[model samples]
Target: MNECTYKNYDELPLMLNVVQVAAVLGISRAGAYELVHSEDFPTLKIGSRIVVPKDKLREWIDANTAQK
Candidate 1:
């Protein structure tokens, strides 16, 4: 797995661009772009750029993860 450099999600900005989201998620830059275009992934398109809200990302993760 790729390593994430962020200390905590709380320290992240309110919204993250695709590159930032890729770093946070430890995914490839291309993969991040792919995710942004996926049906269920949350994203905001600003002209040619795609971004994700921090809170929505957290919620999506929680919604998708299987409960222990």
Candidate 2:
């Protein structure tokens, strides 16, 4: 598990691995796993691999930007 905090979503690549996502979100791989299960985060399952779409992530950020 790793922790990361990416200040700019635009700086993230279009496709990111789970570990990278975890790093960007400042969460551990386990926490990311939980998020995937809840379907609240953006992820795409290709075959047996999980990938996150940067654009979708940006949209989610936009939606949550003003949250308290």
Candidate 3:
């Protein structure tokens, strides 16, 4: 995966691809794929592509972080 860096969430695109997600979360590409495949993750299937909304990803991180 190509390296991606964002100074803040505001720099993120409205939707994130698997590689972007991996970069944002500092996880491996395979780890990102597994995360997107998880039942509770906020993912959208646009035709054959899978994406995660930036806002939803923020909310998900907030929600899950509080649990840990």
Candidate 4:
């Protein structure tokens, strides 16, 4: 984590929207939604939008990458 990195959830000023998350993970929007509904996925709801924390996404990416 550099200066752009966030140490806490509160420190994160923006979140990766569903589409962005899907894009980062190379998945479709429907796939992202499916993961969102699954117990395996972590998410947050703010009013009407669902946003995934960048750190959580990074963790997910790390886990998956390590599997390979």
- What CA root-mean-square deviation does each model show from the true structure? 1.7, 2.6, 1.8, 6.8
Let me know the TM-score candidate 2 reaches against the reference structure.
0.72
Better of 1 and 3 by lDDT: 3
TM-score order of candidates, top first = 3, 1, 2, 4
Off by over 4 Å in 2: 1-10, 66-68
Residues 1-68, candidate 4, lDDT per residue (tens digit)? 11223345455445777776666666788888888777767688899888888888767767767552
Instruction: For residues 1-68, write the lDDT of model 1, one tens digit per residue.
Output: 34566799898899898888888888998898888899999998889878899999999888999999
- Poorly placed runs, candidate 4 (over 4 Å): 1-13, 64-68
The CA root-mean-square deviation of candidate 1, after full C-alpha superposition on the true structure, stands at: 1.7
| Candidate with best lDDT | 3
Better model by TM-score: candidate 2 vs candidate 3:
3
Q: What TM-score against the true fold does each predicted structure earn?
A: 0.86, 0.72, 0.90, 0.66
Cand. 1 Cα-lDDT: 0.87
Relative to the true structure, candidate 1 reaches a TM of 0.86
Top candidate, metric TM-score:
3
> What value does the lDDT take at residue 20 in candidate 4?
67
What lDDT score goes with residue 38 in model 3?
99
Candidate 3, 1-68: lDDT as tens digits = 54778989999999999999999998899999999999999999999999999999999998889553
